[model samples]
Target: MNFVCDRVAVTDAVGIVQKAVASRSTLPVLEGILIKASEGRVVLTGNDLEIGIECVIAADVSAPGKVVVNSNLFGTAVRKMTGDTITVKMLPNNAVSIKCGNSEIKLNGINAEEFPEIPKFETEFDIVLSQREFKSLIRHTIFAVGTNEAKLILTGCLLEASGNNVNMVAVDGFRLALKKVVTEESSVSGYFGDVSLVIPAKTLRELNNIIVDRDDKIIIKCSQKNVRFEFDNVVFTSRLLEGDFIEYKKIIPTEFKTKITADLKSLIEAVDRASIIITNEINKSPLIMKISGGEIRILCETGAGAVDEVVPVEMTGADIEIGFNNKYLLEALKAAEGDRVNLDFIGPINPCLITPYEGDDFKFIVLPVRLRTDVSMDV
Candidate 1:
C-alpha cells in the first residue's frame, strides 16, 4: 500500500490498533499489524485470535493495496519521525519503505495474505450507553474479577442489561463488586429481552482506555459467541466465556446488625496507616475495625509492630467489631467514588458490605477475616 498521512493521526491510529497486537504467538503473522489502504482511508488492524481492534486513519491513498508489517517496528518508526507527514510505499518481495522528513526506513513485512481477518458481527448494535457511565461501571467493579483461570467464567465481569438499567458484577471469591446505572436510551432492535455475557476483564480494560469522553456514545452488540463494542474510530471485539456466572444477587445480605456512614477519605487513610505493620503476605495480620463510642478504630498488630488509629464516624443500629484483609478494605475504599461510604454488617463472621452513601451506584461485599480469640491476637 502507498499512502501519505498526517503523523499525529497515523500515530494515534497505530497506538489504538497496536493494543491488540500479539506479544508472543505461534503464528508469526499474528504478531504483525495489517494495513489496508483504500477509499481514502488506511485501516490498521491487530488481532491475537481472541480480541481484535481495528482503527482507521484518513490518508491520501495513491494506490489501493495492503501489507502486514511488524507492529513494534512500525509504531516505533512512526513515533520517532519528526516530520509532520509520513509516506509508506510497498516494494517487491514484501519489503516496505517508510519516509518522513529526513528519516527513511525500510522494514521487511509479511505478506498481507497471511494476516487473519477478524470475524465479523452484525453492523447494527443492540444497545447504546453513555461512555462516561460505561467507563465508571467498569472501574467500579473490574478489580474483583477472579484471578484463577480454572474457573474461566470468573475471570470476566458479568455484563447484564435488562429493563432500563445495565449492571456489571465481578467476583473473586474474596469479594463481590456490583455497579449499576440507569439509562433511558433504547435499543434500535427489540431483541435484547435479557442479555448477559461474561466479558474478559482485559477486554473491558482495553475498551476503557480507548474511550475519550463521556459525551461519546458506545454501541454494544453481542452474539451467542462474541461481543462487539464500537465507538469513535475504533471497533473492539472479544470472544465470550461460555458458562453461567455465579448468582451473586441472592447472596447480598437483606438486613444488617450494624450500619454506619463514615468519611471515605478518613477511613481510607486510617486503613492505610494500620497496614504498615503487616510485614509479610505469608503471615500478614488483619486489621480490626471496632465501631463504637462515635469513632471507628483500625488496629493491626504483628510480631514486627502494631498500628492503631481512630477515625470519627456516624453509626446506627448496633456496635460491632470486624476483622478484614487490609488490602481488601483499601481496594474497596479506592473504588468508592463518593465522599461518604455506608458499611453494612451482619456479624463479625459475615461479609461486610460497602456502598456509596446515597445511591446504588456501587456495592462491594468483602469477606471478613475471623477475629482472633487469644489475648495476644485480639486488639
Candidate 2:
C-alpha cells in the first residue's frame, strides 16, 4: 500500500484502533494492525476476537493495497517523526517502508489475507445520541460493573431503549447504578424490542474515550449477538453476552424505614475520609451510618484509628443504622449529580437505596454489611 497522510489525522486514527490490539495473544497477527489503502481513504483496523475497532482517514493514495504491521512499533515511529506529511509504501517480500522528513523506517509486514475478518454492521436498528450525553451515561454507570469472571453478565452494562428514552445499568452484586436520559430523536423501535441487552463494560469505555467531539452524533446498531457503534470516522464492534440478565427490579426495595436528604458533596467527602482508615485494616472494615433527629453521623474504625463525621440532614420516619463498604458508598455518591441526595433505608438488613433529590430516573442500590449485632465476632 502507498499513501501520504497528515501527522495529526494519522495519529488520531492509530491511537483509536490501537485500543483493540491484544497485549498478549497466541497468534502473532492479532498483535499487528491491518492497514488498507483504497479509493481515496486509508483504513486502520485492530481486533482481538471479542472487540474490534476500525478508523478511516483521508489519504492521497498512489496504489491500492493492504498490509499488516506491528501496531506498537508503527504507532511509536509515527508519533516521534517530526513532519507534516508521512508516506508509506509497500515493498516486495512483505516489507513496508515509512518515510517522514529525513527519517525512514522499514517494518516487516504480514499478508493481509491472514488477518481475521472483522464483523460488519449489516442489519439496521439504529439510534442517534449526542456524544456528550452517551459519554456521560457511561461514566456514571461503568464503574459499578463487576470485574469477576464468574459473573460474566455482570461484567457488562445493561442498555435499554424505549420510546425516546435510553437507560444504562451496571451492578457488581454489592452496588447498582442506573443512568437514564432522553434522546433528541426516537429510533428505539427495533433497538430493544421490549427488553435490555448486556454490553461489555470495556467496550463502552473504549467508545467513551474515542468519542471526543461533544456535538457529534453516534449511530448504534444492534443485532442478536453483537452491537456496533459508528461515530466520526471510526467503527466499534463488540459481542454481547449470551445469558439472561438478572431481574434487577425485584432486588430493589419498595419501602423504607428512614429517608435522609443531605448534600451530595458533603456525604462524598465524609465517606472518602472514612475510607482512608477502613481500607488500612487487615479485614475489610465497614463504615457505619446512623441517621436520626435531623442529623446523620458516619463512623469508621480500624487498627490505626477511627474517624467520625456528622452532617445535618432532613430526616423522615424513624432512626436507622446501616453498615456498608466505604468504597461502594464513595462510588455511588460520586455518580450522584445535583446538590442533594436522598438515602432510603429499609430496616438494618435490607439494602439501602440512594437517589438524587427529584430524580427517579437515576437510582443506586447498595447492600448493607452484616452488623456486629447480627453475628458475634472479634474486631
Candidate 3:
C-alpha cells in the first residue's frame, strides 16, 4: 500500500481501528491493523473475532495495495510522526516504510491474507436513530450489564425496537437499568413484529466513543445473528449473543409503599460522602437510608468511622428505611439523568426503584443489601 495522507487523518484512523485490536491473541494477525489503499481512499480495519471496525480516510493513493501493520507500532508512529503529512509505502519483501518530513521508519508488515475476514451483512438498515439518542441510551444502562461470564446473556445490554421506540435494558442480577427513547422514524420489520438483540457491553462502550457530534445520524442493521452500526465513515459489526434476555418486565416493581423525591445532585453527594469509609471490608457493608419527616438521612458505619448526612426530600405514602450496596447505588445515580430523581420503595427488603421525577425515560433498580447487625436504624 502506498498512500499520502494527512498526519492527523492517519493518526485518527489508527486510533479508531485499534480499539478492536486484540490485546492478547494466539493469532498475530488479530493484533495488527489492515490498511487498504485504492481509488484515492485509504481504509483501515481491525477485528478480534468478536467485534470489528473499519473506516476510510481520504488519501492520495499513487499505488493501490493492502498491507497489515502492527496496530501498536503503527498507532504510535502515526501519533509521533513529525510532519503535517505522511507517506506509507509497502516495500517489496513485506517490509513497510513510513516517511514523515525528515524522519524515516521501516517495519515488517504482516500478510493481509492472514487476517480474519470480518462478517458482512446484506440486508438494508433496520433502524435509524440520532447519535445523541443512541449514546444516551447506552450511557444510562451499560453500567448495569453483568460482568459475570457464567450468566452469559446478562453480560450484554438488551436492545429492542418496536415501531419508532427503542429500549435498552441491562441487569447484573442485583440491579436492573432501562433506557427508552422514541426515534423520529424506524424501518424495523421482522416476523416477530419487534426486533431484539443482545449486544455486548464492550461493543456498545466503543460505539459510544465513536459517535462524535450529537447532530450525526447512525444507521443500524441487524439480522438474527449479527448487527451492524454505520456512522461517519466507519462500519462496526458484532456477533449477537444467543438466547433470550431475562424477562425483565416482571422484575420492575409496579407499586410502591413509599416514594421520595430528592435533588439528584444532593442525594449523590450525600451517598458519596457516606460511602467514603465503607470500602474493601469483608462485611461488604451498605449505605443506609432513613426517610422520615420529609427528609432523607444517609448513614454509613465502617471500621474507619461513621458518616451521617441529611438531605431534604419530598415524600409521600409511607416512611421507610432501606439498605443498599453503596457501589451499585452510586453507579446508578451517576448514570441517571435530570436534576430531580424519585425513589420508590415497596418495603425495606424490596428493590428500590429510581427514575426521573418528571419522565419515565430512565429507570434503575438496586436490590437492597442486608441491614448489618452492628448498625441501628430508627425505623
- Ranking of predictions according to lDDT: 3, 1, 2
How does model 1 fare in lDDT? Answer: 0.87
Q: Could you give candidate 3's per-residue lDDT for residues 1-379 as a string of tens digits? A: 7889999988988888888999778887888999999998999999988899998999999999998988999889879987899999999877789999988889898888888889876753377788998999899999999999999999999998888889999999999999999887763654347778899999999998888648588878887788889898899988888898999999999999999999999999999998889876677768999999999999888888999999999999888888889999999999998899999999888999999999799999999986854245533
Worst lDDT run of 10 residues, candidate 2, spans: 187-196
Over the stretch 191-288, how does candidate 2's per-residue lDDT look in tens digits? 45644678998898888888864868887787778888888898888998768877787887878888889999988998898888765645888999
Candidate 3 stretches greater than 4 Å from native: 187-192, 373-379
Candidate 2 — which residues are off by over 4 angstroms? 189-195, 280-282, 376-379
**TM-score for each candidate, following the candidate numbering:** 0.95, 0.95, 0.95
Error of 3 at 322 (Å): 1.1
Worst 10-residue lDDT window, candidate 3: 370-379
Model 1 TM-score (2 dp): 0.95
TM-score of 2: 0.95
Every model's Cα RMSD, please? 2.4, 2.1, 2.5
